[model samples]
Each structure stands twice: as C-alpha cells, then as structure tokens.
Target: MKAYIVSLAAGVAVGLLYNVIDVKSPAPPIVALIGLLGMVAGEHAIPFARMVLAHVTS
Candidate 1:
C-alpha cells in the first residue's frame, strides 16, 4: 500500500511538472511503463538464471 501510494504521488508530481512546462509527453506512458517492467524483470532474471545453472551444474 505504501509503495503504491509513493508511486502514484511521484507520477502525479511528474505530470504536474510537465503540465507547468507546457510540453507534450515524449512517449506513451503505458509503453514506457512496460519498458520499465521489462527492464526490472530482465535485470533480475539474468542473475536468477545463473544461480539455477550453477546449482544444476554443481
């Protein structure tokens, strides 16, 4: 719950800033969010795969 609130607050703050600047969003928000999710998953997956392989080989 706390994490969700923080994320929502940060997003709203960024949106407010962009509104103040009068600049359009550079990319689609959903696309960018998906990319971030991919990044997080990939970052953790590589280490997890290595651990699994190491255990199997040993």
Candidate 2:
C-alpha cells in the first residue's frame, strides 16, 4: 500500500513536470500501464514456472 502511494505521488510529479515542459510523454498512458503490468506479470511468472517444474520433477 505504501509503495503504491509513493508510486502514485511520483507519477503525479512526473505529470506536472511534463506539463511544465510542454512535451508529450514518451509513451501513451495506456501503453505505459500495459508495459508496467507485463513487467509485474513476467516477474511472477518466473517463480511460478520454477515451482511447476519442481513439482513435475519430484
């Protein structure tokens, strides 16, 4: 929860900075969010795969 709050605050700060600089964000918001979701899923996937492999071998 704390991490989520901190990330939200940081995102707000970056948004304000982008408005001040008058430049478009590198990636559209939806695309960037999807990328973040992919990263999180990928991180969990490795551990899940390892667990399945271990179970199969045993």
Candidate number of the best lDDT: 2
lDDT by residue for model 1 over 13-54, one digit each (tens)?
A: 888899999978775789888999999999999899999999
Candidate 2 clashing pairs, residues 3+ apart or interchain: none
Which candidate achieves the best TM-score against the true structure? 2
Output the lDDT of residue 6, model 1: 100
Pairing residues by index, what is the TM-score of model 1?
0.46
lDDT of 1: 0.91
RMSD of each: 5.5, 4.9
* Residue 26 C-alpha lDDT in model 2: 77
lDDT of each: 0.91, 0.92
lDDT, residue 7, candidate 2 = 95
The positional error of residue 12 in candidate 1, measured at the CA in angstroms, is: 14
